[model samples]
Target: MATDSPHPTRKALRRNVLALLAVLAALLATLVSVSSASAAPTPTIVLVHGAFADSTGWDGVATRLSSKGYPVQRFDNPLRGPAHDSALLEKKLAAIDGPIVLVGHSYGGMVITNVDDPDVVANVYIAAFAPAQGEFVQGLLNPIVYPGSRLLPPALQVKVVDDPTGVAGRNLDGYIARPYFREVFAQDVSVATAADMFAHQKSAALVANLEPSGPASWTRVPSWYLVSGQDRVIPPALQRFMASRVAPGHTSEVGASHVSMVSHPAAVTAVIEKAATA
Candidate 1:
């Protein structure tokens, strides 16, 4: 039997090479898996505050979301008007890469509804005004249509401001009078916190509420609504009315005020995270 065989060293070397190749293959597979997982996109959570409040209202929510490994952005709404704010938001959204979970509070809802961006995968309303096309925020805030709204005189104070755009009567800034800020906008938060929020409140121009919303993105995109059960600014009834228009079972209710994200950050974060995953 003339069986030819490699030298012992060569055979050992060949065995070592095979083992090294197997190790390399396993390592390469693991690296690919890690790369794919790290590359998986997690939608950015964009928070926009509505009338009588600023981006600070989203501090709690943003912190909670960040803790859970979700990217959060609190938009500095100009509070000019839906037409202007939405346009600005559209531009802002355009700059962001990957899917987005757009969450709006108060007038911010109006602005988000008007924005038409493919990146916005979900529209989450936190006691925000989700107006339909041709419908204005003011119209939805009507005390008659949805009573219990306290965002009226005594509670709301309007001041005429110089319009850089030179449009007469379009530059009015509406603030929730200091006395009623807590009750009207954030009743669930502490008095001190509410006062701080009031002091830093960003008023929306009257025209912002009056300007009719354009094509509502909610109609096309998936929407998640969180109704502030104790909200007096938009009225809980009105919130439900708007929520009803969204996809069924996408509505959540928290027994908080207009600023649920402030009063119940965990709940708000959960809703937004759900939307992000969805």
Candidate 2:
């Protein structure tokens, strides 16, 4: 007897998983916890992109969720800073009725946490920062900013610009310097891909980074966290600390860069779907 062997393709594997998920969803009503196995008709999944990125970065995750029959949408985060940006997010959330599973990547986590809308029943942090009360995005990046960070060459750098978004309402805007974007934020992506991501980055206002958060929404809403272990933008240690603060058994660690949601969409979507059903 001869055994047939062929290398499995990523697409083939994904299709298999999608099929399994569909079966599980069909049986969720009886075989599993309705809150955990469901892949549809639960809460809406909202994807929020962080700095040095646009909503397009969520394409992969959104596609996965869509394939699973889950309603998904990506919001264009105006990196106007936290308070103002969160307010804008609140407005967007207002347009989306019913329960929501808010998922944010990078700085977008700050915005979602700050929004804290009641409609948002759950939050998913995808290689994201979930700052505690009084914490700021810039403050978290200070180690990488001022130097002595563990990584050589320091993975990230920021620059201040005039309020280009117009929504910032502040004098200084913060942008991730393009020079290190590929190595820092999207290290898992290719040069050509990273270039496109860099080109589409939206700058956050400096005040947005300096502005401290109020009480965190995670404290009120159940949350899930996905930490990209190879992240250079926001140290992985910080990601773990934040994830620990969330509900236990709701955190996962994936080996990827800061932009893990793009590089590892399946992992990211699984977490979001978990939150949506939970």
Candidate 3:
């Protein structure tokens, strides 16, 4: 009898509950749509490794970037010559759909500088070699530039001689033959990791190529330079000189070896993050 007396009231309460749930569902859908629209697009980081090395050199750095929700790609340049390498890098840059940040380590720095892509928002130099107009790698390196260099283990020196390309020869087996890669390439890396790098290395002909970088993109694009104070490969002085030429909006120095990206990823990433946002 009581139920019969409250039948209409019960129906009304059920209707209210259903209506409330429908409203909630609609609100949730709206929220999802808004979130989708507001989410920031992930930045693309194209890593170009310097001579006598391949894409694997960027492994740890790539992993760190990926963890932070950034999409990363590594280029395997033929390393035949500067013109050829620059063309390859430009091809990769053309494929990117949106904003991009180009990172060059060691000789990779030179490669990025030669890439004539206008879409590149920022260039990040990580203890990388940045040459000036009409300058080549050889032009920037001299015995005085590298002092107290211990990263070039004797084993690596031997390998360079054995390498048929002459640029790396057998030395490609030891580590990066370039003074910069030897001194700073693994500054932040462990002995084990550095040794491992030596175990699997590729000889690059481009190292010996004296061809000048025709035109540098750094002249037009905003840039950042991360100088490794303890770098032995390219020399701290050369880094300073090159940085001054680029006139990057931001410049920082880290107590790392030439390969700061491998040794101090956090520091390298911090600079990259700034470049990406800028």
Poorest 10 consecutive residues of model 2 by lDDT? 146-155
Best by lDDT: 1
Instruction: Give the clashing residue pairs of candidate 2, or none.
Output: 81-208
* Of 1 and 3, the candidate ranking higher by lDDT: 1
Winning candidate number (TM-score): 1
Q: List per-prediction Cα lDDT, in the order shown.
A: 0.86, 0.79, 0.74
Model 3 regions more than 4 Å off: 1-40, 144-188, 206-209
Which residue pairs collide, candidate 1?
Answer: 50-107
Per-residue lDDT of candidate 1, residues 192-265 (tens digit): 99989978887667767778888888889999999989877778898999999974689989999878888899
> Which 10-residue window of candidate 1 scores lowest in summed lDDT?
163-172
Q: Summarize candidate 3's per-residue lDDT along 1-278 as a digit string, tens digits.
A: 34467889999999999999999999999999989866757669998887556777777788888888888988886665567778888988888887789998877887888888877888988777777778887677655665544434542343434544344344233345544443445656766777667555665553544768778888888889998888766688788778887755488899987767767878888888888877
How much does each candidate deviate from the true structure in C-alpha RMSD?
A: 4.8, 14.4, 8.0
Error of 3 at 19 (Å): 32
Q: Which stretches of candidate 2 lie over 4 Å from their true place?
A: 1-40, 142-170
State in Å the error of residue 96, model 3. Answer: 1.7
| Residue 204 miss distance in model 2 (angstroms) | 1.8
Residue-level lDDT for 45 in candidate 2: 87
lDDT, candidate 3, at 256? 86
